[model samples]
Target: MKEQYMITHEPPNPVDYNNLRLEGGMSGKSREASEEGLKNSLFVVCVYDEETFIGMGRVIGDGGTFFQVVDIVVKPGYQGQGLGKLIMEHIMNFLEKHTYPDSYVSLIADGSADKLYKQFGFSYTYPKSRGMYRKY
Candidate 1:
């Protein structure tokens, strides 16, 4: 199989978002939720295998000052293929192109994925502050 894939920073399709998040064990997000969230997203990217979406990522927030990288996911079978890196590259590119000087870009790194995010200039906020979250 070929090892190359295309990256598109357009908004992801609702079905694609469902499949992408489902593969990451976050299937609880309904189509309604996906529709709403995607409508407000600042950026989204996906790595497709022909017609199938194998990976995806998104950024959510206001346009100029605040941005958060969210939902970076690759299918289990597609893991370890640098699809994560590809996704991050697209996300970083979007941030670079859209952000103004001194703008803040943030993401909550899950598991050991901090290493990947770090490659794109994301660092731990320890000593300054720690990331916090609430489960619904």
Candidate 2:
């Protein structure tokens, strides 16, 4: 039996954003931070099971030259259910339509999730340019 989930460009509310991340084993962010940050989303796809928020993926960048795929999360109970791929499909569609030839799309795949991104034509940058981030 296939479950029905709604995928929408409308992002979750601040509470949902913070809760769903924690539910999916990702780190938590303050509701205040989420409220402010979400307003700046370049593109976002939020997944819902009935009215319950379950998963989401967001693209954030300066609108050109660079795009970072962030917050790709599916609730623990919903893992391995193809929700991540669905989120990526929408994210890719946004990129395809908006990106220029020189645009760079980047992500940090935690654990084995890199396999999923690879299917979408993402290549790792190694032996050349490496990634650096300042996580507080």
Candidate 3:
């Protein structure tokens, strides 16, 4: 049977965000941090199976000259069903409509996930510039 899912331009609640991140093998952020991050998102897309949150993705930054794709995750059981692509499609749509030509958009792909981002025009930033981050 084909499962039905709902996609919305709404941010998931903190609990759902943390749960999905952990379930997807990403680090879980504190509830307060998750709340604050979602509150500051430039755009968010969430995928749900009925009332259950299954996947989500968000874009955050100044919304003008800089943007970063963050927290792209899908629940373990739902990982290979094209939900990730659906989420990225929405993220790209949002970027296309909201960003200017000079805007800089970026994402730090983990493991094999780089291939997914590549499908949406995200390229490696190695030789010219490297991706750097500081963890406290």
Candidate 4:
């Protein structure tokens, strides 16, 4: 059966970050960091099919000068559908409404998803700038 879904800017809960294990690094963050991140973030999108959460995404950073899109995820069974696009469309829409004219909005596009993000005006910064990560 095709699932009907709704997207919301509010997180499922402040602690769902820990409860749902939605951390983006090698291992999930501690409950305190996760809670603080959510509380301080400017944007969050949670996708639900009826009552079951099928996906989520968020944007974090200083609201005025920099914004990074993070934690975009879809439940495994819901993969291959256009839900990622839907989730990202919301992210784009949020950026449209809130981003200052000269502010930068960015994401670390994964796997083949760069193609999808390109359609929304995202480009590779590889040659001009490299993306580096620090692991703890």
TM per prediction: 0.89, 0.95, 0.96, 0.86
Model 3: per-residue lDDT, tens digit, 5-100?
888887888988899999899998999999999999999999888998989999999989999999999988888888889999999999999999
Clashing pairs in 2: none
lDDT head-to-head 1 vs 4, winner: 1
Alpha carbon RMSD to native, model 2 = 1.2
Clashing pairs in 3: none
Better of 1 and 4 by TM-score: 1
Best by TM-score: 3
Cα deviation at 31, candidate 3, in Å, is 1.0
> Order of candidates by TM-score, top first?
3, 2, 1, 4
Candidate 1, 43-129: lDDT as tens digits: 888788877778888999889889999999998898898888988988888888999997888888878899999888888999899
Which stretches in model 4 have alpha-carbon errors above 4 Å?
1-3, 18-27
What value does the lDDT take at residue 108 in candidate 2? Answer: 93
TM-score of 1: 0.89
Which window of ten consecutive residues has the lowest lDDT sum in model 1? 1-10
Query: What is the Cα-based TM-score of model 4?
Result: 0.86
Candidate 2 residues 18-94, lDDT tens each? Answer: 99988888899988889988999999999889988889999999999999999999989888889999999999999
